[model samples]
Target: MTVLLFGITKDIVGSSTLSLPVSSTSRLRTVGELKDYLSSTYPRLRNLSSLAVAVNNSYAEDSDKIDNFDEIALIPPVSGG
Candidate 1:
C-alpha cells in the first residue's frame, strides 16, 4: 500500500510517502492497525500514539477502514503559537 504522509510522521516513518511489499489482500483496515504496523516497521513510532491519520486528505479515526488504493496520510504532531 502507499501513503502520503506529512508533519512529524515523516520523521517517525522516515519518509513522506511510503510503499510496502505486503500482500494486496492484506487487511490493515483501521488507523489503529496501521499504527501497529507502522510501529512494528518503524520502531521509532512507538511513542506516537497521539498522531492522527487522514485518508484522501480527510481526518480519520482509529477504526477507519484503509483500503489498498486509498491515499492514506499519516499526519503527525505540529506545534504553533
Candidate 2:
C-alpha cells in the first residue's frame, strides 16, 4: 500500500510517501493495525497528539479494512496562525 504523509508526519517519517507491503508478516489489514504497525516500526509517530488516516480520500475508522490497492494517507494534526 502507498501511504501519503502530510505535515509533521512527513517530517517524522522523513518521506512524503511510504510504500508498505501487505503481507502476512506485515499484517496491515485494518486501519487500527496500520497504526499499531507504524507505532512499533516508527516509534516517533507515537509522539503526535493525534493521527488521522484517510482511505480513498475519506477518513477511515479503526475498524475499516485496508485493501492492498487502497489509497492511504497519514494526516497529523496541523496548526497555523
Each candidate's clash count: 0, 0
- Candidate 1 lDDT over residue span 13-56, tens digit each: 67788986567327687778987888787887777657788888
Across residues 1-81, which tens digit of lDDT does each residue of candidate 2 receive? 899999998998899999886673256779999899888889999999999999999999999999878899999998889
Q: In model 1, which regions exceed 4 Å deviation?
A: none
Q: What is the lDDT of candidate 2?
A: 0.89
* Local distance difference test, each candidate: 0.77, 0.89
Q: Write out the backbone clash pairs for model 2.
A: none
The residue pairs that clash in candidate 1, if any, are: none
Error of 1 at 38 (Å): 0.4
Q: Judged by lDDT, which candidate is best?
A: 2
